[model samples]
Target: MSRRSSFVLAALAGALMLSACANTVRGVGRDVGNTVDATGSAVRDVAH
Candidate 1:
């Protein structure tokens, strides 16, 4: 295959993989945020 075609195929595959990862990335972010919040709350409780 030509270089241009190979580049396009690679870009398309990367885009698809990134799109699939978007949701899980968001969920992971939320999970981390929640965990941090819980830890902060626990620390506050301990301090108080």
Candidate 2:
């Protein structure tokens, strides 16, 4: 009983940590994508 409870707690903690990491990575990717898009638009404007 006690062993099972400990395992469950550990699993929950690991899931939470992984979720946070994934969220951070997703947010960074979005920011980078936006910057790249803006840069591309600026270049197109300059060419015209």
- lDDT (Cα atoms) of all candidates against the true structure: 0.98, 0.99
- Cα RMSD for candidates in order: 3.3, 1.9
Q: Would you list the clashing residue pairs of candidate 1?
A: none
Best candidate according to lDDT: 2
Candidate 1 is scored at a TM of 0.60
- Please write out the lDDT profile of model 2 over residues 1-48, one tens digit for every residue: 699999999999999999999999999999999999999999999999
- C-alpha-based local distance difference test score of model 2: 0.99
How many backbone overlaps does candidate 2 show?
0
lDDT of 1 by residue, 1-48 (tens): 999999999999999999989989999999999999999999999999
| Cα error, candidate 1, residue 4 (Å) | 16
* TM-scores of all predicted structures: 0.60, 0.74
Clash count, candidate 1: 0
